[model samples]
Target: SSPLPTTVFEDEATAAQKAIDALKAQGIQRIVLLSHIGYSNDKSIAAKLTDVDVIVGGDSHTLLGDFSAYGITSSGSYPTMAKNKDGDTVCIVQASEYSKAMGELTVNFNAKQSVDSCSGKEHLLLGETFTRKDAAGKTVTLAGADLDEVKAIIAKDAQLWSLKPDASAEAVLQGYAGKVDALKKEVIGTASDLLCLERIPGMGYSKTPGCAEATRAHGGDISNLVAFAFRDMSITSEIAIQNAGGVRIDVPAGDVTIGTAYTLLPFANSLFELDMTGTEIKAVLEEAVEYAVKSGGSTGAYPYAAGLRWTVDLSKPAGSRFSNLEFKGKKDSAWTPLDMGRTYKVVTNSFLAVTGGDGYVTFKKVNDAGRGLDTYLDYAQSFVDYTKKTKVLNRLPVSEYSTQAIYDKNGLLQQ
Candidate 1:
């Protein structure tokens, strides 16, 4: 008999102004609106709204500080200034993402309750410097002054943190800690062999653990396991391909625990299904191999499919890289040549299948065309479910996969 509350609004500006008016009606003179709609949206809001004095914004993960000496790029200056509708200044600031820095702003108001001057610094947070590789995998040293400032901040934080602990919160955390300790030791699955997940730096290929034989195995043992888990969880798709980078680490031979699975496949990528034609599938593989060849075999676009296999010749040109493609619907089914005209139901992680992650452009295109469907299954949970259902995990050796070779100039297989 009653209409629903106006809880869901269409426009962000309308919702924001409504809240601003409500607060102003309550005798609030100055407003510092904290927002996550990103830097550009903050500017738009400040331009239209004269009531807001300051906006601390985020979500774009824009770095607004001078971090060049510390090897960080800044999008703009800290405390970026904006002009409001009433010709007043509105201060907007955003700290960078990944908890790497803190933005501090101080404002001084004039006699008329307007900000006279504002200044702040984005403090670069750091930990004890260790020998670490840069993004290009080159060894680099942290700046001495930055390192010293980090150490000082660490010491000061330690002193402040040691001053007091909330008794109730500490007790709650301790109870959770005890449960976590037990969960860490609880065995969830068992592995009979060591899964070699050693990947060549910049190259997606990997070698068997403690063995000399190397292969361009995109999924490797661990990633194959993850892909298999995706296929097992999907109701409409028989094939599952996960990005090689999604598999984080190697799983050792022993009992598998909750912690073990978490370390191996940590990210919360959801499973997505795609209704794709075999022609598009071939194109996706070609893009991956082309990326690898173009990047000197340094890309993670390599595919690791659960129900499909194909041959890749690195010596060949881009579109001709893949051949002898086959798909097996069931574990006991015979492998059949993939029909280029037939549409197949495929499954992959949300990152690669939906966002074209790791250069899966074909998948993203199909998804954007409304052919992709979200299964809403968490990747790690699928692995957990597979482990529980199967009860045993085994290392998939190179012998288990279809033949893959690199051709030399003379059309001969290279060693």
Candidate 2:
């Protein structure tokens, strides 16, 4: 591709500043910036931009205001105030994630188009709680309740769902719902053994051990299987890597259904291949290990690769966390240290290969340099293909991973 066009996308703060400057130049004061850059960035902009009066932001999924009445935790105060470089006041606010609450911020601007005073509250919308039979066959009432009078008032709201459904919309939803239900019960394949959904503790953020803990110490069964599937489908890939977060669930020791496959790899990310040297691959692994350590054992960034293996030492600093790196060209081949100078064909999800989701910035750099190829292969489908080919998924293979005494007996990192 003629060295993919270099288009520099500005970060949120820079882009917001550009827009604010433009508006100020146009004599537009009392500007309310609707931002999705997140709460922290909003505060940064408030501290930096003198012209912005208020910022309604999202993306950190931050909860603001005193939601204690509703039993929700507020991350920070509502309408957080900050002074700009010129000492002008700016107001910042954000609603929590997934529309669970709506923020109502009232901003009063002074004559100079700066915030004078502000007050706001987050309104939490909850479902109508009702009484139900307990496991002991006793009737019990849920703590939160919606009175009949309140229900009557809400019934008058045109936006609320009606007891009488719309004929056309209901028909469409019913058709799709039926199809979904059928697919959930449809068998795709089978497994000879159970794939534990519980995360391997001690290795990830948790410290509790599970049946699959050993496998996940290096790479879990689902992740390894997914990586193998990607390589199998690719034309130029000699190895494949999958992120732990991408593999969402486990396959039980029974028939593997379509639902099972979908649950295993829920993301829509496609397969991507790239030419990366052994050195770059090692760096990628190091990044993953460091991320796990820094995140207190978060598995999201942990890398699981087919035809690749390595050990991690939490005692080591960031760049040196990974060691004993090895790779194999085929299943029956002997393992060998990664050749730092040799470019190897590697396969990974498009999310990591292109945008570097979950902090795989090294891969993103390679993709930006036009060295990566977008195979456009559906990731979840790759799992399905592997299931059909293997026919039965037995227990996960023993891991080649190793880690030092990262924590002391008191559950703290050993110094």
Candidate 3:
């Protein structure tokens, strides 16, 4: 209504009041606020703005818009809204961040006055598509083209980049130097044990939510571990910090496979390091979170803190949020407090380290950090090897979510 306050509120309460007044004047009975505000933030807003009907959001990449009273939803991506106290359904639908998917949310409002029954479904936008099973036992679905649709969407026949006749992969498209994989892989790493993102019996989802590790199990933690594991990577070194948005592939729980790794990191995102002051590093984090809702934002680039651990406050203003920063030494000793003057060799992908993703201007500053070869592939290989050796999870699989059905805080299942 009044400039639809976008991005993370910045002044949500004030903005909401303005919208409510304006909407009331329009005789808009039920208010549906479609936003990118994260789940936690959404809940806070819903509570404060009683007039607001339902908030459909994205930013956190959260899948579920409606969470049960217990406040537990599986992975942030592809979450299904649970339910609310008023019985009015709040829907959250997002076609995964990369535009690979389009979110379709159908809300049927009652022509009558009072609240009533409602239902909906979340689906991926498959643009005229085809499917095939790859040798890796994964089903690859590709976007197909109906000769008619393209003619309508594109301006002219000349707009079509090619007049040449011979072409095999019809749906293939390229962004930057990277080519899109028309074939989507179905599964990776078979597990006799469930690498469960779903909550288990006698265990809260937090105790072990299956599939939240979708990103980490396939790579994230594993790759960084390898990067830091190497003798060469160090603080004060120029390193590649990857945008987490790029790590979108999911590895279904099962047998460890090679093809799965390729699909997960379907990019030329090479490993590079940056020479950033401890203070500057904090600034980078702030940039990632603040800009997460905009083109300049990224949670994927949120620096997984390989070989280092630092505290980040999500609620704080973007830039000033992260505090008490520290990094574990190359020697693997106690964590050292951050020193702004001293530069550290932080490792990440080429995207964030150079491209200034998530408003990380500091990372773009070439004053110090250096670039390096992408060993992510090498690390990916090592993960499959490591899983084969361990034959099971070694690190503690943690579920950051909380729910009443599964168990209590201590991890003892609640009856």
Candidate 4:
């Protein structure tokens, strides 16, 4: 048998240009790129391409419109306009993350095959019923005048859509609903307390009461736990790293089910192990913090880890921000200063294991050097397995948290 040829991947702009050229050759004058490279990359691609007129993007999960009336903050305006290399108009848009909203954009092209204008808004899909917590802290569904007032508010907001489920779709779903419901109901374990989900510490964005106060100094509880699970499942790995964005949703105090695990780590990512020196690990953390906090990138790029801890001062420059790095091989081991020359096995999701995602350039270098190995373990399943083995989920001891302390940009300590 002949040796198989290796596949060579091209950069986004190059690949997009090649496809656009083919389309133009086929008499397609207007090009709309259905992109998953994320909002930031989409804007860069739009600026580089001459033929692409519009970009519908994903991956970053950016909300590209004003949705404040619904108590949601948006990243930018809908149909963010840019200019191509030829100085022609290019429009880019993205809906929010987690299927919470849908973007609708309209582009008008002139006879010369250039974009003349673009406009649109995101519609937040909602059900007919609404609920609120009463003075007694019990959830209750609205009714009577309250229901009417809620309906009126929805009617007034053009971006809010309250739609009933389609009868035919409901019938189709019913066929498989029984098995799906059974799978979703399979309880793996229980949480002793609400594990709050927050991308960045001190943001006060956690929905659970007291979560913000608890996590303001330590960072996200769920993200740290997910990183610990990855390290635990890897068996031989000494450390684990996870991007905050990878773990989604809070785990309320109660039974943790298969559905909960899936919802938490929803992406189709697998576990990967990389042999890295402490110096490399430090560089990776700096890169993540630089991109997310210092460079005004997505807060989701913030790094979380098991077996590692550091204090970050936002007032300092990127390279100098992280300090007092420590490492422990096992839960029972004493924490010691990280040795820059020592090599250790690090486990992380496939997303951060590769280069160019979330500014983890050091991971790319180690992977390219042939020191990386894929465990082929589904990340979400790893958490499920961990839950079953432990039988209980509780907030990790304060000492085990990855972030020991953080200082704000003004050099004041964050509470």
Candidate 5:
């Protein structure tokens, strides 16, 4: 979220224009904007600006180069060119997220100081060491001829880099290495059953075996668990909603650790409590479902919740896709029909509550209306705390799943 007041902050395009005007007044025409707005916004801004020649972007974690040899997917071509207002080229480039790769771009300016050409590749940085799972399903580091062959293959790929860590940087990291390692290994709880991670029911996106089957009837197990954690940790929230993508990984049945909790909920998100009417709750769920399924938007928009349940039918049109909405308050003994006129306190992550991230427009509206409060409870840490409190983590019962039933476009039950 922007720290600057709304009255003080200018939109990206407007700010860029002002900066460009100042630069042009100084006889500078070749302007490059370092942007973190995102790929879509970068393209939009590029189309609006006539003087900006290049946009190096992040925030969307878009992979913009071919990485097929390494079995990685590319979002689009590197240096994606967009036409400015004057029809001049604007080069946009971004490497993938989490420091996995770096974008190397070369931009050429014409005599008029306009963008003439741009080219680059996203270089995937890697250590010299390589490991692979053997036939016994054990991870083993590659060595000897195998290691040599792996290095040879990496050397052949332009995007793949087999570089050694800088000694100075390694030395700096070494000071905190033990602490980091210990924190990662710190035990938090135990999972009695594998908590499967799935974005949408029956999508079969999980890498875990039988995960698709496990989640086909219900939604993501871990996502629902995260929602439960939020609601449980909150003092005033009646229900908690979590995006499917917010919870990252499958939790295999075993000892759960701080590393597992962090890996599962990796983002630096906090909890927020929102006062929303039941009508608003249903509206947000419909919005998320419409975005996730019918609209062909990111499946990550799919929602899982605690203290709320609904049946979704993809065969139905938007605004009518969800039905049988129900809610169970923290003190309620049984599930009851959601009263659209009644307002309820809902707990959600900062991403949804603050920025309305993942197409949750209703949340943004509620927040804008000053009906939300930031709990400042770290989302990942909430899971760690809940795990520590509960000691035994298990998948929520089917009845407790936010998505009670889901039907595909053909009206066939997905479960």
Candidate 6:
């Protein structure tokens, strides 16, 4: 919404020059620039670039399904394309962002008006409502009904819009639907009645979510599932980390599709492992906690862990947010500080691996860190491999994940 540089548009002058160049070459009377430029910029470009006929743009994601009613030019500039002092054909169209609807207009070219005519004309008036006045000055509803006729007629037929390259068009096209029957079918994953989705239940010992529990049960069960599936690369004996933001979609507990996994991890991120010490791990844990709270918490509610678990004290400084970090290798052993010098294998998504995401910058110093690998196939393959071997994940509790540290002579450990 902010008026910043757009990914789609470079500059209006350059864009307009391109339009003019195209017209001179083809000897075309009209040109259009469908754009995502905000309403104001669209007018400025249209006014400066006089050679174009129409612009069917996209960016602001405005809904032209109703069609725009009117376009105002700069105070000194001429009207729009459709009407010039010389009355030429010009139009602009755009449907709002997202996939709700669109608008269109049909023009019957008249042979009388010379094609070169450019005067006080307004190009497009494709709003939800347009009125005409009568002898008594009563308003005229040129098109009847809001949702019924005019809107669809114009959205599908007319030619008035700015440039919206990536925005989806409402052209009538077939959409394929699948897995209709598969939804009701039984999934063959390991069935456990104790599978819990809540983090801290009101009952006795809170049972974690299956997905979370699975990651804890087998560090990197979630991240490594995909990491090891890649050719010549597998997560081995490391603390695999998954930031909450990356898992965009929740895995459905049913017959899953190859597409489902793709949707769950849509971002194009590679998998790479890091050899970090427990000191670095502590820094990341605290950072993750702080990042979670800063991002409205809900998105970060599900903290990730592979070979370790750390709790945070919200009152502490953000970088050192976590007050406790420990690893678990045996039962009856209390959690302890991680060794600073010891290196721990770490696998994470490429976003954080290079960019120092989630405030883990220590790894940024390790440039020759990881082998770039596609994790999508690895993820799909992991599920496939799991189903073949066993459905049940047998996820262990988060309590099993603790940092490693040796106590003093008295065997008393330090945080």
Q: On TM-score, who's better, 1 or 4?
A: 1
- Give the alpha carbon lDDT tens digit for every residue of 150-269 in model 2: 466546643222243468998999999999989878776888876654222244332334544444344355556667777877867988877777877766678998788888888878
What is the TM-score of each predicted model, taking all chains together? 0.74, 0.68, 0.41, 0.64, 0.71, 0.51
lDDT tens readout by residue for model 3, 254-282: 65455555544555554555556777777
Best model per TM-score: 1
Query: Please, what are the lDDT tens digits per residue for candidate 4 over residues 1-415?
Result: 1111245657989999999999999999999999989899998888888788988899998987787776788888898999998899999999887877888888888989899999888888899989999999999999999999999998998899998989999999998998889998999999998998877788865678888887898899998999999999999899999998888888999999999999999998889899999999999999988887855587888889999999988889887889999998865569999999999899988877764478888987888788888898999999999999999999999888898998988998887
User: Which ten contiguous residues of candidate 5 have the minimum total lDDT?
Assistant: 1-10
lDDT of 2 at 99: 60
Off by over 4 Å in 5: 1-8, 11-164
Model 1, span 212-311: residue lDDT tens: 2433333356766777778888977877876666777767789988888778888878898999999998998788656654655535566777778777
RMSD of each: 6.8, 6.8, 17.4, 7.9, 5.9, 11.9
TM-score of predicted model 3?
0.41
Model 5 clash pairs are none
> Sorted by TM-score, highest first, which candidate order results?
1, 5, 2, 4, 6, 3
**Cα RMSD of predicted structure 5:** 5.9
Per-candidate clash tally: 0, 2, 43, 0, 0, 67
After superposing candidate 1 on the true structure, give the runs of residues whose Cα lies further than 4 Å from its correct spot. 1-29, 37-51, 60-78, 96-114, 119-171, 198-219, 292-298, 397-403, 406-415
User: Least accurate stretch of 10 residues (summed lDDT) in model 4?
Assistant: 1-10
Clashes of 6: 67
User: CA lDDT of each candidate?
Assistant: 0.73, 0.71, 0.46, 0.88, 0.88, 0.47
List candidate 6 segments past 4 Å from native: 1-31, 34-53, 64-92, 105-176, 179-188, 198-233, 245-283, 295-298, 326-345, 350-384, 401-415
